[model samples]
Every structure is written in C-alpha cells, then in structure tokens.
Target: MKQAATASLLAFTAGFVDTAGFIALFGLFTAHVTGNFVLIGASLADFHPGILGKLLALPVFILAVAFARIYVLGREKRGHDGAGGLLVAELVFLSAFLAAGVAAAPFTDADAPLTILTGQLAVVAMAVQNAASRTVFAKLSPTTVMTGNVTQIVIDAVDLLGGASAGAEIKARLKKMAPPVVTFALGAMAGALGYVALGFWCIAAPITSVVLIFFLRRGAASA
Candidate 1:
C-alpha cells in the first residue's frame, strides 16, 4: 500500500510538472526529456523561439541524473535510505523551479535567458526523480514516464483475458501498474488546468505532494 501510494504521488508530480512546463515554457518537456528531441526537430523545419531550451534539456537531464546516482550511492554506502535525501533534493529543485518560473512569468520570449533557466530547473528536478526511480525507488513502478507502464498493462490485460497467465499473477500486475498510469493522466489534466488558472503558481501543488510522499515514506529503509 505504501509503495503504491508513493508511486502514485510521484507519477502525479511528474505528470503535473511536465504538462505545466509544456504549456508555460512553449512545449518544453521537463520530465519526458526525450520528447524534446521531437520538438527540436520540428523547430528546425519550422521556427520556434523555445528551441534553445529544448536543445539544452537533454544535457541538463543527463548531468542531474549523474548527480542523483552519486548522491544515492553515497547514502547507500553509509547504510541510509538514499531516497529520503533525494526526495529533499527534488523538493529543493522544484521549489527553485517554482520561484524562477514565477519571477520569469509572462514569458513573452521562449528563447529569453530567464525562460531557459526556468525550464532547466524543472528538467533538473525531474532528472533527479528519473535517477531515483532507477536507484532507491527501483522497486516501485516507474513514476515519470507512462509508455512502458501502459504497454505492460496492456500486455497483462490481454494475457489475463486469454488465460495465458495465472489469474492471481495478472491481477497483481494490474494492481501494481494501474494506479500510477491513472494518476499520471489525472495529474497531466490537472496541471494543464492549473497552469491555465494560476500560471507558475500551479507548481505549488506538486511541491506539496512531494512533501507528503517524503513524510509518508519516512524511514522505510526500502521502497
């Protein structure tokens, strides 16, 4: 139950941040960084002012992932749950993203320096999440990206319907995979709506969710 709750919360955060950034930062994908590659290519054929931010997201994500891994590894070596510390790190970056975004709001130019900085801050926060998902939270279903989760869910459903797998096993898989996917979708919608209503202040929702996760999973030692 704890694992499911945490996974759902993280997925919600990822979806919320990704959508809000996309709407506000001119198609910038803060969580699904690879999606920016498509935007970058499109921008080349057509002209988009935010192309620079898209171009920079991949490298920034890479660096943040490396940092997250190292930080988690160091904590594991000391016999601590690295995820707690990483959660704090993510919260700090998210807070920074919110502050930068609010200050940089009314983004008239996507190529402007502040716009790029704000987008990168979001990228870093999601990168930390991506890395932590692979490290400390590896036991949890992925929270940021839903492609693989949805694929697996479909496969499992088909197998269950065909009786190709044991009923209990298929049900178990569905239970594990469904919540995050659903929550992610809901979060994406909420994010788009929140951005439309509150602009960058919408980020406060995800920040609060992260705080809840941190407390909910406190001292679990394993996720």
Candidate 2:
C-alpha cells in the first residue's frame, strides 16, 4: 500500500513537471515518449531541432533505467531493498531540474548557454521519469504520458465487461485492468493540481516522493 502511494505520488510529480515544461517552453511533453518520438521526427523535418532537448532526454533516460536496473539487481541479490528507491533518486533529480528551470528566465532570451543547460535539465528529468515509469513499474503508472496505458485500460474494461470472455479470462482481464486506471487518474489529478497551484514549486510532488523513498530505503536497511 505504501509503495503504491509512493508510485502514485511520483507519477503525479513527473506529469506535473512535464506539463510545466510544456507550458513554459515548447508544448513538447518530455514524459510522453510516444509523442516525443513523433516530435523528434517532426523536428527533423521542421526547424525545431529541439535537438538539444531530445539529445538531453533520450540518452539520460536510458542511462537512468540502466542505473536503476543495476541498483535493483544488487539489492535483489543482497535480498533487500525493492527497486523503488533508485527511481526515487531519479525523481529527486527530476524535481531539481524543474525547480532550476522555474528559477530560470524566459526562452525568448538569447542566452544560449544557460538556456541550453537548464533546458537540458528539464527534459532530462522528464526522460528519467519516463524510463522509471515504463521500465521500473510495468503494472504501475509510468507518468510522463498515458496514451498506451489509457488504451490498454479501455481495452481491458470493454473486453471483460463486454463479455467476450468468461471466468478465468474475465478475471485475468480485470486483473490486468486494475492498476493503470487508478494510478493514471491519480497522476492526472495530482499533476493538474500541483502545476496549477504551485507553479514551479510544483516540485512538492517529488518532494513527497523523496519522503517515500526514504521510508523504502529505511526498510531495506532494516532488513
């Protein structure tokens, strides 16, 4: 239950920061890889290289996942510490990036170095969020984006309640149907509220996530 709560809060934080990036700079959503992939393609053709943004995003996100996987594997071999805390670290860095951006100036300014640096920070944070979401928690809400999760949830509900299958199949369908429905909604609601009310301090989302990480880490240490 506690882990679920942690994942939910982190997911919400990811979305909140990503949306802020959307509002502040390009409407490009850093967490939504599917959309970002398309954007990358469009960018190739259009003048929106957004190249630096994508550059920061793609590789760092991959590395975050790799690092988390390695950490989680070590914890697993040692027989303690679930895979969650590594992700929490990722989220903390993500929040730091977003907060830094909040402290930065408008994009219209020609200060290329600071702009690129902070801009990279923002997208890379989201990239880490994406990697954590999709890679770390298969059943959990991966934040950043929801097209795939939303589609699968609808498919499960309709296929199950639609009565195409029976008994075990129905149970299995519903079982699969469960997590994303709740978590995604939770992420959306929290993300909306945080970004709306807090502006840049919307970082409170991951701050809450860090608290969860602390508890999870304590559990590992005790074990």
Candidate 3:
C-alpha cells in the first residue's frame, strides 16, 4: 500500500509537470522526452522557431539523469538510501524550475534564453525523477510513462475478463497499474486547468506533492 501510494503520487506529479510545461511553453513536454524528440524533428522540418527549447531539453535531461546516477551510486557507496537523496535532488531542480518559470513569466518567445532555461530546468527535474524511478524505485511500477503500463493493464484486463478462472495475479497486476494511470489523467487535467488559472505558480502543486513524499519517506524510514 505504501509503495502504491508513493507511485501514484509520483505519477500524478509527472503528469502535472508535463501538462503544465506543455501548456506554458508552447507544447514542450517536461516529463515525456520521447514526445520532445518528435517535436524537435517536426520543428526542424518546418523551421519552427521554438525548436531550441525542445532540442536543449534532450541533452539537459540526459545530463540530469547522469547526475542522478552518480549521486545514487555515491550514496550507495556510503551505505545510504540513494532513492531519498535522488528525491531531494529532484525537489531542488523542481524548485529552481518553478522559480525561473515564475520570474520569466508572460513568455511570448519560446526561443528566449530565459524560456529555454526554464524548460531545461523542468526537463532536468523530470529526468531526475525518471532516473530515480528506474534505480531507486525499480521495485515499483513506473509512474511517469504510461505506454507500458497501459499495455500491461490491457493484457491483464483481457486475461481476467476472458476467463473466470483468472488467478489473483491478474487482479493484483490490475490493482497495481490502474491507480497511476487514473491519477496521471487527473493530474494532467488539474495541471492544465491550474496553468490556465494560475500560470507558472501552478507548479506548486507538484512541489508540494514531492515535499509530502519526502517527509513520508523520512517518516517511514525512521519508523
């Protein structure tokens, strides 16, 4: 149950940041790097002016993930929970992203230096999250990307629905996969709406969620 709650919260945060970034930055995805790649290609082909941010996002994300791996490895060497450290790093980046974004508000130019920096920070924050999910939270279901989750959910549903003899394993898998997907959708909606209503300050939603998770993890560890 704890794992599920953490995963769902992280999924919600990813969806929230991704949607908020997308709407605020003229369709740049903060959490979904693959989407940014497609956008980069499209921008290149069409000579789009906003391509710089998308292009920079990829490398910045890679750098963030690499940094996270190094940080985790270092922490592990010292006999510590690397995941917790990674979460802290993510929070720092996210806070920076939020600050930069708010400071650069009324973004009319996507290629502007401040706009690109804000987008890059957001990408880095999500990249840290992606790295942590793969390394620190490897035991849990992925919370950021939904492609594999959706595929598994569909397969599990088919097995359960096709036969009354379907075992508890199928049900367990569904239970594990369903919440993140649902919560991600909800977060996306909330992010879009929040961005429309509150501009860059909408990031406070995810920041608060992460802070909560950090404290929850700390409490769990201490207990």
Candidate 4:
C-alpha cells in the first residue's frame, strides 16, 4: 500500500513538473527528456530560439542518471538503503528548480541562461526519479513516464474483457498500473492550471508532495 502511494506521488510530481516546465520554458520537457528531441527537431525546422536548452537536456539527463546510479551503488555497498538518499537528492534538486523558476519567472526567452538553468534543475530532479524507479524502486510501476503503463493497463483490460485465463495476473497488473496513470493525468492537468494561475510558484505543491513521499518511504521501510 505504501509503495503504491509513494509511486503515485512520484508520478504526480513528474507530471506536474514536466507540464509546468513545458509551459514556462517554451516546451522543454524536464521529465520526458526524449520529447525534447522532437521539440528540437521542430525548432530546427522552424528556426526557433529555444534549441539550445532542448539540445542540452539530453546530455544533462544522462549525466544526472549516471550520478544517481553511482550514488545508489555506493549506498548499497555500504549497507544503506539507496532509495531514501535518492529521494533526498531529488527533493534538493526540485527545491532548486522551484527557486530558480520562481526567480526567473516571466521568461521572455527560453534560451536565456537563467531559463536553461531552471529547466536543467528540473531535468536533473526527474532524472534522479527515473533512476530511482529503475534501481531501488524497481518493484514499483514507473512513475515518470506513462506510455508503457497505459499500454499494459489497456492490454490487461482487454484480456479481462476477453475472459483470458490469467485473470488474476491481469487484475494484479491493472491494480499496479492504474494509480500512477490516473495520478499522472491529474497532475498534468493540475500543473497546467497551477502554472496558469500561480506561475512558477505553483511548483511548491510538487515539492510538498516529494516531502510527503520521503516520509512515506521512510515509514514503510521501518515498518
């Protein structure tokens, strides 16, 4: 139960940050970094100005994931839980993202130095989250991206509808995948609305959500 809840929160954070950053930074995808490739192509074709930030996102994301893996491996080697530390690192980067975004709000140029800095902070934070999902939280459904989760959920649903023999497994997969998808959609909507209503200050909600997840994971670990 706790794992599910934590995963949901993490999904929400990713959705919220990605959407908010996209809107604020001219379509920069902090969580779904690959999406930036498409945006970069579009920029090149259209001669847009935000290409630099989009160009930098991929390498920054790769480096962040590498840092996360090293941190997790070091912790595990010393007999410490890596997830908690990764969560803390994510929170710190997220807080920095929020601070940078708030300070650099009302952005007029996506390729501006401060704008790129803010976007990279968010990318790093989400990269840590992606690494955590693939590492210490491998048992949990992916929280950053929803394409696979939605695909699995649909497959399971179709099987259940067709009266497949693996009903139990289908149902289990649905239960595991549904919450993150739903929460991610909700977070995306909320993020769009929040950014429109409050600008970058709206990021505080996701920051708070991460704090809750940190405690939730700690409590679950002790339990």
Candidate 5:
C-alpha cells in the first residue's frame, strides 16, 4: 500500500513537472522522450531557433540515467536503499531547475544559455526518475509516462468486462493502475493552472510531494 501511494505521488510529480516544462520552456517535454523526438524533427524542418536546446535534451537525459544507475548500484553494494538517494538527487536537480527558471524569467530568447540550462536540469531530474522507476521501484507500476499504463488499463478493463476467470487479479491490476493515471491527469491540469497563476513557483507543488515521499520512506524504514 505504501509503495503504491509513493508511486502515485511520483507519477503526479512527473506529470506536474512535465507540463510545467512544456509551458515554461516552449514545448519541451522533460519526461516524454518520444514527444521530444517529434519536436526535434519539427524544429529541424521549420528552422526553429530553439532547436539546439531540444537537441541537447535527449543526450542529457541519457547521461542522467547512466549517472542514476551508477549511483543506485553503488548504494546497493553498500547495503542501503538506493531509491532514497535517487529521490534526493532528483529533488536537488528539480530545485536547481526551479532556481534557474526564476533567474531566467521572461524566456524571450530561446537561444539564451540560461534557457537551455534550466531545460536541461528539468530533463535530468526526470531522467533520474525514469531510471529509478525501472531499477529501484521495479515492482511498482511506471510513474513517469502514461502510454503503457493506459494500455494496461484498457486491456485489464476488457478482460474484467469479458468475465475473466481471474476477476480478483484483474481488479487488483485496476486498483494498482488507475490512481496514478487519474492523479497524473490531475497533476497536468494543476501544473498548467499553477503556471498561469504562479509562474516558476508552481514547482513547489511537486517539490512538496517529493519531500513527503522522502520523509514517508524514512518513517517506514525507522518503523
């Protein structure tokens, strides 16, 4: 139950940050690599001035994942939970992202170094989350992206409605998958609305959630 709650909160954070990045950074998707690829192609064809930042995001994301994997492996070697360490790293990166965005307010210059730097920080934080979800929280449903989750939800719904013999199992699957999807949508909505109202300060929502997750894990470990 605790794991599920934590995963849901992480999903919410991903959605929140991704949406905020999209709006604040001019269509950049920190959490969605596939979308970034499409945007890159479009930018290349249209000669978009921000193409450099978009092009850089993919490699930065990959490097972040590599760093996270090494960090997690080292922690496991020393007999500790790597997930907590990864979460802390993510929080730090996100804080840096928010700080950079604030310092670079009115992102009118797409080619500005600060604009690219802030975008890179957001992508790096989300890449750590992607790696952590796959390694540290492998047992939990993915919290960064929604494509697979939605597919599973549809399949499970069909099986349940089709009167599968494993009704309880299907129900359990639904319970595990539904909350994150719903919360992610809600988070995206909140992210958009919050950005309109609070600008970069909107990040406080996800930052608060990550802090809660860290403390919750600590409490669980202590207990």
Candidate 6:
C-alpha cells in the first residue's frame, strides 16, 4: 500500500479505461473535463441530441460529486476507507460500471437511449473519481489528472527552486505525483496497442479495468 503503487494502479487504470470510454463510447472522456468539453461541443453542434442525452450526462459531473460524498458519508457512518476509501471506492465503481457497459453495449447502439444510458453510467464514474481525487490528494496532492498534474509539476518545480519552507512540501508533493503520471502514460500506450491489435474487441477496457480494480481493492485492504 505504498502511495506510489496505489497511484500506479489508479492512474494506469483511469487512463486505460478513460481512453476506452472515448474509443468505444463515441467521444466521452471519463476523467478530464477538457476532453469532455471538446466531445460535448462537437456532439452538440453535430448530433444535437434531444434533451435526453444531454439530460443523461448533465448531472453526471454533479453525480460524481454526490457519489464522492456518499463515500465520505459511508466512512462517517462506518469509518471504512476513511477519506481515502472514498477515492478507492470511486475507482471500484468505475471498474464495476465498465464491466456493466461491456455487457450492456450490444443493446445500446449510436441511438439516444443507449448512448444516454452509457453516458450516464460513465459520467457517474467520472464524477466519483473527480471529486475523490480532488479531496484525497488535497494534502499529499493527487495526480490522477494529467492536465492538472503536468501544470502543477511545472509550478511545483518552480516552487522547489524558490528556497522557501514550502519547497519541502513541493518536493513531497512531486514524489507522490510521479506514479500517476507514469501510470497514465503507460495506459495511453496500452490503449493504442489494444486498439490496434483488438480493433472492435474494445472489451479490453472493462475487463482490464476489473482486473486493475481487483488489484487496487486488494491493495486498499492491505493499506
């Protein structure tokens, strides 16, 4: 349950699954809002989905937060994953959802109900991961987000050179941050490989995600 290993598992899994969501589910990026915006905008301009699709996805970001709070409450109620457990369960749900999506895909084509259902499912997962990462890493700092992580790494590097007391904190932060960066990169690489080798066999996303979560939950238990 080293921080490094936990990050390695979560980041790689996030990237791999998020990339799969993007590839298989038409352009939804499960983790990052930057990519989400690009996809949503394009879909709006082109597809102009009925309120149902947007309605389905509209509250996902909010729902992610709600899910995080639910985890928070779960800990408060039973004191399980503590605050960190919230993040762990978030990843756990994503893994479970991906499995559901893999099984549910055929029934859902490019149509509204199917897309809406799938979008809602993924959105809920992203919402959980997003809020959990934001809170869990507030102290140690979380790197599950590549866009923010890269930006902060630059900022931290600058702060490290400032000869301030906070430099120690910055260095500490970067140490925790490193694993996610590396793991996410590996996921991106693996995603490309899987897409090439498997083609429509995108079932790799959910299956590998389940494996990652299984290991992650094991790590969390021992943590």
Best-performing candidate as measured by lDDT:
1
Q: Which ten residues in a row have the lowest lDDT in candidate 1?
A: 214-223
lDDT, model 3, position 84: 75
Error of 4 at 219 (Å): 2.2
Q: Please, what are the lDDT tens digits per residue for candidate 1 over residues 96-194?
A: 999998987899999999999999999999999999899988999999999999999999999888987488988988999899999999999999999
The segments of candidate 2 whose C-alpha lies over 4 angstroms from its true place after superposition are 1-4, 44-46, 82-84, 109-111, 122-144, 164-198, 209-223
All models: lDDT? 0.93, 0.59, 0.88, 0.92, 0.89, 0.62
For each candidate in turn, the TM-score is 0.96, 0.71, 0.95, 0.97, 0.96, 0.71
Regions of candidate 6 where Cα sits further than 4 Å from its true position: 43-55, 82-109, 136-140, 159-167, 199-223
How badly does each model clash, as a count of residue pairs? 0, 0, 0, 0, 0, 3
Rank the models by lDDT, top first.
1, 4, 5, 3, 6, 2
Q: Model 5, range 41-142, lDDT digits (tens) per residue?
A: 887678666677888988999999999999989989999879988899999999998899887887997778989899999999999999999999898888
Flag the better candidate by lDDT, 3 or 6: 3
Check candidate 3 and list the clashing pairs.
none
TM-score of 4: 0.97
Candidate 4 residue-wise lDDT, 73-187, digit = tens:
9988999889878888998998998888888788998778999999999999999999999999999999999999999988889889999999998898899999999999989
lDDT of 6 by residue, 1-223 (tens): 4546656665775677667666666665666645655556676678733334444454666766876777676776775655456545555666555566655654345455656566566666666656656655444335346877778888888777877678778887788777688888887677667755664355346446536655765777787
Per-prediction CA RMSD (Å): 1.7, 4.0, 1.5, 1.0, 1.1, 4.1
RMSD of 2: 4.0
Off by over 4 Å in 4: none
State the weakest 10-residue window (summed lDDT) of model 4: 40-49
